[model samples]
Target: MLNGGPASDDHERLLLAIEAAGLDLWENDLVAGKATLPATRTFRELGYSREEVGDTLAFWLEIIHPDDRPAIENALVAYRDGRSDNYRAEFRLRARSGEWVWYANYGKVMSGSVETGLNRFIGVTFNINERKHREEELARINRLLSAQNQQLDQMNAHLEMLSGTDPLTGLFNRRAMNECLHRLTRSAECEAGVLFVDLDDFKKTNDIYGHDIGDILLCQVAQRLQSCISADDMIARFGGDEFVVLIHGRGEGGVRTILEAACERILNILGQPYVIGDLLLNACGSIGVACFPTHGTTVESLTKRADIALYRAKRQGRSLYRFFDSGMELDLYNRDSLEKALRAALKTRQLELRFQLQVDRNLRPIGAEALLRWHHPVRGLIGAMEFLPDAVASGLVHDIDNLVLENACATLGKWQHDPELRGLSLSVNITARAFDSPSIAPAILALLAKFGVPPEKLCLEITEQLETRSFVTANTAITHLREQGVRIALDDCGTGFSSLESLKSLSFDQVKIDGVFIRDINTNTVSQAIVAGLIGICRAMGLQVLAECVETPDQMEYLLEAGVDGFQGYLFGMPLPCAVLEAGVRDAPQSQRG
Candidate 1:
C-alpha cells in the first residue's frame, strides 16, 4: 500500500538516501505481478529514460541476461519459499543502447515473513559494469600466463644437459666430476686414486696467444688426459687450467706403482708440444697424486689433499709430480705458525729491509731494491718467499708493504744530504695486493711527501701478478704514480703469462728480465735468444731493460752486450743493511764489489 499522511516524509528521506549512495530503489508487488514504475533511476541509468522501460514484473525479469535469468529466478523462488535467507544476484541487463550493462541486486520481503503472505519485495541496485570488465580481463591474462609457464618448464628440461659438461672442451665439468666422485665413493671399501693436474704457465700462454689458444690448449690437454685413463676411470675439467683423473682398482704396491706411472704418464703426455693455429706452443703439466684409503677415504678429503700435493709439485718446478705426503700437512701448521710470527714481527722489529744494490752496465750503483726479511729467533733469516705467500693470503702483506714504502722513502730522504747518494734511486717491491689496491698510490705519495724525498728518487717494482688483476685499476695506479714523477718498473718479466700484456699495455720506466733467463743465459741458447729479443723490444719501445741474477762477469758481460741498462744479482753483492751499505759505499766502495 502507498504511504499515508506522515509516512510521505519518511519515504522522501528514503529516496534521498538512495540518491546519496548512488543507488537505484525498486519494488515488486509479487501478488499483483507488477514491478516499480518505469520512472525509477534503474531504467534511466540503462539509457531507457522511462518510456522504453515497462512496469510489469515479467518485463523487468526479461531485461536480465538470458544466461543469468535462470539463476536469478531460482534465487528468487528459493528466497520466497524460505529455502534461502535472502535474495542476491549479479546479472546483466539489456539497455536501450543495445549493450548489456552489469548490476548487483539485494532484495528482501519487506511486508511480511517468508512463512506468511508477502506483499512487496524491495531491493537496491548499483551499476557494476566497469568492475565486471576488469575481472574478465584479469581472467584472460591468467590463462595466457599459465600456457607460457608450461612452455618454460619444457625449455628448462633441455638446459639440464648443458649443466654437466664444459662448453669449450666438452669434458665433464666440475659439478659433473663432483657427482661422479659421490657415486664412486659411496662405499668405504672403494679403492681409487685421484690425480690433480694443473697446466704450468697456462696463464702466460693466454697472455701471449689470447684465449683462443688457451681454449685450444685446454681441449688438447683434455684429449691427452683422456688417452691416459681407462674407460672405467673418470676424467674431468676441474676448472680453470686444472683437471682431475679418477682411477679405480690397484693392489697395495702395484697400486702405488700404477698410480706413480699414471702421474708420470699424465705429466709426460701433457708436456708435449701443441700446434695451435700456426703457432708451435710448448705446454707442461704438474700432477698431484692422492690414493684412496691412503690419502683419504672420502672425495672431499682426497681432492683437497691432492690439491695440496699439486701446490708442492708446482713449487718444485715445472713438469713435475708429487704424491700427498704427511709433511704437507705439517706445512699447514708451519704456515699458521709463520703467519702468527709475521703478525708480531712488525712490532718486534724483526722484520727488516735489506737493500739489494742495482748497478748500471758500467758497474756503478744506481739504486737498491728493498727486500723484506724476517729474522726469526729459531728459523734464522726467513726469506720473503718463505712467508710472503702466507702474508698475502692472510692480508698481512699490505702492512708489510706499507713498511717497505716508508723505509724506502726515509732512505731516499737520508740520501738527499750525501752528494754520492743524492742521485741514487730506491726501489721497493710492491706486491700485487698492495699495488692494485686503491689506496697504494696515495699512501706512497704521502710517505714521500712526509720524508721530503724526490719522487724521481723512488721506484716501485711490481711483478706481472698485477696483470691478472683489474687492468684499469692497475693501469690507473701506474698513471697516477708516473704522473707525479715516480718511477715504475715491471719486475720478473718473462716468468709469468701477463708480462707481455703488461709491457705492451701499461707504461713502465724499466723492465727487469727474470732471474730464470739470466741464470742460464750463457749456455741456454733459448734463454739468450729470449733475452736478446726482450732487450731489442725494450730498446725499440724506449724502455730501459735490466737483468737480474747476474753472478759471473760473463753473465753480466753477455747481458751488457745485449743492451741491458742495469744489473742486480749476487755477482754485484748480497742484500745488505742500509747502514752497512752506506758505510761501505762511503768507505771502500771497491771492497763492496763481489
Candidate 2:
C-alpha cells in the first residue's frame, strides 16, 4: 500500500476520517491508465476484498453499467483535457450478490496539470441506492397521477356535452340554442336562416293518446327534422312541441327560393304518418322563416319575428310555412301599444269588475262570479278577452288580479249589510300568473282582513291549466286558502290535459264544467254523457257541480235533470256592475232568494 513515500500525520488523519465515514477513496493515473482504490469499509461492503483494490482504469470501466459507461468515459476525458475542473456521475455497478447498486462518483485532478502531460484524479465513491429507489417510486406515482388527470378531463367534456343536449331528442336544448345564436350574430361573415317549427294540434294528440305517446311522437318528429337538414344545419328543441333550426351559409341570389324549398321539404317530411307501437298517427307542422340581416339581426328580434310568422302560418291553416313580412311588425307594434295602455290603465285604476250571478236550479241568485272589464278612453269598453292576453304577456296580469280581489272583498263587505245580498258569496277568477305568486295567499288574506269580510263569503277560481301545469304552487295556494275558510273552485274544468288526475289529487270545493260541453248538452248525446259522467264523479267526490254558458230553457232543463248543483250563464242574467247588482238585489223579492 505504501509505494512512493511515507504518509504525513495530516494525510493519515484524513484517510482515517474518510474510512470512518464509510467512503472508499479512488485515484486515477491519467498517464499510466491505472487506478488505485483504498480497501475501505464501503469497498468491503460492496463485496470487493483487499485483492480487488488498486484495479486498472479498464477494470473500473468494466464494472460500470452499460447504459452509464459512455457518460463516465466522456466525463473522464473532459477532465483530463482541462475542459472541466472535475468529473461527477451517478451510475450502477455490479456487486457480489449479482445485484446492481447505485453509486455517486466525484473526482478532481490531484497532483499534475493537463498542460504538463501529467495528471492524476482523486475522488470518492458513495452508496446512493436508497435515494435512487425513492426517485423511481415518485416518478411512477407521477405517471399514475397524469393518467388519472387525463381521464377526469375526458369525463368533464362528456358531462358538458350532456348538459347542453336534450336527453329525449338528442338535440341541442334552448340554452345551447341561445348560445349558438349569440355566436352566429357576433360573426359578421355568418348568414343564417332561422326556422321556428311548432307541431299543429299537439295538445289534442296528448289529450287523446296521453303524454307517453306524445313523447314518442315528439321523438319521431325530431328524427324527421334531422333527416331533412344537412350536417352544417343546427336543430334545437325549445321546449314542448316547439323546435328551432338554423340553416347555415346562405346561398347568393335565389335565397328565398332556397329557403322555400327547404321549408317545403320539412313540411312534406313531417306530414308523413308515424307508426308508434300499434297506433298509426298523422301529424303536421307549422314553420316560420326568418333570415339574418333581412327579418332581424339579433336573436330576440329573429325569434320574435319567426314567432309572428308562425302565428300567420297557423292562422292561414296548418301544414304550411310563412316568411316574415312587415305586416307582422305592425301587429307587434299594436301589441306593444296595447300593453303600454294596459299598464297605464292599471296605474290609473281604470279597471272594473262586473259580477255575474250563479243561480240555483230554481234560477235564484246564490253567488256571483267577478269578471274583469277595462273601460279605455278611446277604445270604449274593452272585454277581458281583448286585453288580457297582452296584459299576461307583459307580466301585468298579477296586478290586475290583485285589483279584482281587493274590489271583490270590498263588494262583499258592502253586501254583508244588505238583507237581499247578505247570503250571496262572491267568486273571483285568479290568473295563472297570479296564482303562481308565492305571496298570493298572504295578499288575499290581508285583503279579506282589511275589508272585514268572512273568508267563507269569498271564492277563488283557478283554471284546470293552472292546476295541471303548476301542481305544487297551485296546491299550496289552495291548501292555504282552504285552511282560512275560503272556497276553491276549479274553473273551466274539463278543458285541460289532466283534469281527472288534478280532481283526484287536489282538494277543490266545486267543479265548474267547461262551456263547450254545456253549450251542446241539449242536442249532443256525447255531451250529455260527458256532463252526466262529470256530475256523477262530482257527487261521488262530494264536490259541488256548476254548468257554465247555459243559454236555453232546454239546456237548463237538461242540466237540472243531470243533477247539476248550480248554473252560471246569460239565462241567469249577464254580468252587472257592483252598484247595479246591489240595486237589483235590493229591488228583488224575497221569494226569489235561494
Candidate 3:
C-alpha cells in the first residue's frame, strides 16, 4: 500500500530523481528545529553504500568547504530572518571519497505555517567543478600567448635596425643611404656634397695580406671616416671599398678645406703600415666629390656624376680627389653610345688592328706593338685612346683581344718570310679580362706555333694594376707562360702600384716608368727622385727599365742619367703603321737606320 496524496507523491518523485542524478536532497523542519537528508547518490557512483544517511543539517554542513561554510551559514541566517525570499550561491563541497567539487545551490524560501501545500521550500544542487577547472586552464593559456607576442615585437625591432647596418664595417649600408637621401631632399637645407671615396687599388691589399687583414683595414677606414664627418653628416659604405659621405654645410671654400683635411688625414693614416699577424702593408684611397645643387638636383644624378668624377680621378692617377662637372655627363653619354656601337661592331667585324714599330735604343725595329684602330663606316678612324677605356669598362675587351690575336697571328705568318722582319717580335697589351680567360696563355702559345715564330719574338705588357689579384690560378697561368720563354713587362710602374715588394713578388722582366713622371723628370725633383728609385730597383732586380713620354732632349738626357735602358716617346718617333715603319727602316740611310 502507498500514500496517494498528489503533492506528497510529486515531492517523493522529485527527491527520488535528485538522488538518482547524483545529488543529495535535504529538508529542514523549522518548527521541530531538525534537518534530514538522503544518503548521497554520488556515494553509490563512487563505490560507497546508501546506508550512510545524514541525520541533521550539521552532518552535511561539516562537509562544506571550510572557507565557504561561514558565507553559507550567513546566507541561511539572512533567509531565515525574512530579509530575502530566495537564495542562490556557488561554493565548494566534499563529494564522496573526500574529493572536492564545486556545487551551485539555488532555492525559494517559504514562510512558517502556510495553509496551502504550495507553501513549501524547493532547491537544486549541481556539480560544476569540471567546468570551473577548464575555465582556469584557458585563462593560463591566454596569459602565455600575451607573453609570446611581446617577445616577438622586441625581436622584430632589433631585426629592423640590423637590416640597415653593414655587418663588417658596422656603418650604415647603401639601403640606409637611399632612405637618408630622400629625407635630405625633402628638407629645406642647402649646400650638401656627396663625396664618393674608393680605396686606390684595394685589390692589391687583398692580394698582399689576405682578405682577413683587408677586412680589418676596411674597419679601420670606417672608424677614420666617422671621425672625419660631422655629427650632422652621414657616411655610408656603398659596397666594397666605396663609401659615400653626405656633408651638410655651406661655402665652397669651407667644403674644400674640410674635404682636403679629411683626404689628407685618411691618406696619412692609411699610409702607415697595417700590421696584421706578422705582416705589415699599406693602402690609400681616392675621393670624388660632387656638390649638391652645383652638380645636380637629384640623388641619382649626383651619384652618377660623382662616379664619373671618381673614374676620371682613378684614370688620371689615383690617391687624389676631383669635382664633378657637366662635361663628365656629356663624356659619359658619348662613351655609352660608343659602347653600344662597339658591341655591334664586334659582331659585324667593323673593328681592325694596325701594328706600330717598337724600336730599340739602336733605332732597329726589334718588334711591332699591335695597336687597335676602329674603321667605323660613318666615324672614320676611331683612335685606340678614344674607345679602349669604354671597351674595358663595358667588359667587351675579351672580344677585342680575341679579334686582335687572331688577326695578329695571321699577319705574322705573312711577315714570316720577310728578311728584315723574320726575327722581329710582336708585343701586345693584355687587358685584365684577357688574363681571366683560361685560354689566354694557351691561345698565345697556339698563335706562336701557327706562325712558326719563337716565343721570345712575342711580348706581353700588363699594367701593374692587373697584378693585384694574387689568384693562385692566375699566378700558375702566368708562370706557365714565362716558362715557355715569353717576356712580361709591368707597364706604368711609377704612378701606380710600383712598390719594391710588388715588383719582386710579381717578378716581371721589365718595368715601364709611367710617362707623366718621365715628362717632368728634368724640372720636378719629386719626379726625378721617384724615377731614380724605380730604376735602381729595376736594375737591382735584373729587370730592364723603359722610360715613356720623352718629348724633349733634356728629358731624354735626364732619363738616360736615371739608368733607364730604353726610351719611347715623340722625341724619338710617334706610333706609325707597320708599312711606314718598314719603309722608314728600309729607305733610310744606313747611318740613320743604325
What's each prediction's TM-score? 0.50, 0.57, 0.70
lDDT of 1 by residue, 1-594 (tens): 566756888888888988899888778777777875442777777776555566776657778899998889888888878798889888999888889999888889889665667768888888889999999888888888888888887777756667888888888888888888887778676778888999976876786568988998899999999999888888888788999888886556666787887887888888788988788887889888888878887779989999889878876765899999999978867877888888889888899999888888777788888888999988898888878878876779888888878888988998998876787788888886565566788988999999899899898888426644356667888899999999999899887668887887788999999999998998999999888888888988899888888899999888877889999999878999998777656663663332
Q: Which residue runs does candidate 1 get wrong by more than 4 Å? A: 1-327, 464-470, 520-524, 588-594
Candidate 3 local accuracy as lDDT?
Answer: 0.72
What's the true lDDT of residue 141 in model 3?
Answer: 86
**Every candidate's lDDT:** 0.83, 0.84, 0.72
- Per residue, candidate 2 scores C-alpha lDDT tens digits across 1-594 of 454445666688898898788677887777788765442555576787766755666656666789998888788788777788788888988887878888888888778765676567788888889999999999899999999999999999998898789888999998889899988888887767889999986876786578999999999999999988898888999999999998875666555777788899999999999999999987889999988868888999999899889977876777999999999889878988998889899888789988888888777788899999998998788789888767766778878888989999999998888777889999888875576666899999999999889999998887425534356667888899999999999888777557887787688999999999988897899888888888889999999999999888888998898899899999877889888877776667777785
Clashing pairs in 1: 204-497
Could you tell which candidate, 1 or 3, scores higher by lDDT? 1
Ranking by lDDT: 2, 1, 3
Better of 1 and 3 by TM-score: 3
Candidate 1 lDDT (Cα, 0 to 1): 0.83
- Name the candidate, 1 or 2, with the larger TM-score value: 2
Q: Rank the candidates by TM-score, best first.
A: 3, 2, 1
Candidate 1 displacement at residue 543 in angstroms: 1.1
